[model samples]
Target: MTGGPTLPALPPSLRAPLGLVAVLAALVVSVIGTLYAGHSQPGRVDRWIVSPTADPVGPPWRPVALTLDFLGEPAGSVLLVGVVVAVCLLLRRPRAAVLTVAGVALAVGTTTLLKQLVGRTIHGPDNLSYPSGHTTFFTALGLALALLATDRLGLGRTAGTSLVLCVALLAGAAMGWAEVALGAHYPTDALGGWCTALAVVPATAWLVDRAADRLESAGRPEPR
Candidate 1:
């Protein structure tokens, strides 16, 4: 409680936890916006990035999602985290490894819960199908990357860290877009994904980061 490893920021301190909560608050805005703007289905926010396969018969969201597909598969966003963790584990970063694995679980589990609890049917509206799972994974992975890639991982600024971030965002966006392209998810699904991610991802990441920080701080002896 006093001090612990933080998520995305050093934990052991209140600032980091507060910052994470604030960041997650963005999800609320996203959800509310989706409820208001979405016509019980995904809307055409072509202003933002979408897919390209928007044919006359298909859900317009498909083209929007397809358009957002970059580097092909949506897994691009999380691949960076895997690589980072691989390097970290090889380099002897136990904390980063645990957080990466746990974050993935947390993100995926939460998404499944949302899909079910929200009752957002697939293919069409009638349910809360605004948020996209692809988007959830994408955003969740990004949060994990930001949280897990700390001093323990040894990701130097001049080295792979920067590249990892760039790839993560681009990939997540692409994957999220792809959902719409396939007509599997609505545009709002992507939005809900982001909101859910921002809300839960940060909280879990912060909790995990605090645990790591606690261990780290414990290693340092106090000056008697």
Candidate 2:
């Protein structure tokens, strides 16, 4: 933990563009991957992503499998809610916090509705599995955190933050991959989740921050 050399931080303005690019790429990949997996080889991909294939002699679960189950499950949302609440309290941005919570609800609800509306089968089981829940959760979390990190880093050097944001977003994608890899969902399902995250994360970040200080005069509070 202590051995890594300190990395110079990059500027947020530069980092923001890169982050946007990454998000766009992830969304694209997720979309294509999902569509291909479900539409072309649903049975095969489903088996690959869903069916358990562990060592014959050892335990039934791999670490990755266990980890996926833990994060992708419904319970993760409660934990996410807790984190958001804590972060909002810490930042003293109640409205932004409220927006984040609302965003999550809307995201999850929309995902569910879309899944049903799309009538995309869950592949192996009777489950409705478009838009991997874990992927969405992680994407949303990463987007929020990335925005927060960028704000803190400002328009100055933030290579350190950049690295951190990369890892965070990748981790979220990894979770989605796990779901798809395990056949719990299709790649498109994950992609859909990622898309939802992208569509709203920036807006939520703005909501959380409200108006920039530039809008109001420096010396006076606008209102009570």
Error of 2 at 69 (Å): 2.9
TM-scores vs. true structure, each candidate: 0.59, 0.62
lDDT of each: 0.55, 0.56
Query: Best TM-score goes to which candidate?
Result: 2
Model 2, stretches more than 4 Å misplaced?
1-61, 93-96, 155-168, 207-224
lDDT of 1: 0.55
Over 58-97, each residue of candidate 2 has an lDDT whose tens digit, in order, gives: 2453467557657646786677677876885576544445
Best by lDDT: 2
- Taking all chains together, the TM-score of candidate 1 against the true structure is 0.59
Prediction 2 TM-score vs. true: 0.62
Give candidate 1 regions above 4 Å deviation. Answer: 1-26, 33-40, 43-53, 56-84, 124-130, 147-169, 213-224
* Model 2, CA-based lDDT: 0.56
For model 1, residues 1-224, the per-residue Cα lDDT tens digits are 12123333422333344355536555563564445443443345532545444552256665655544432244654565677678656745555566666765676667676665566565455554545656766666665555445343545543334444454556456666576556656656666666666566546656766786778789899989
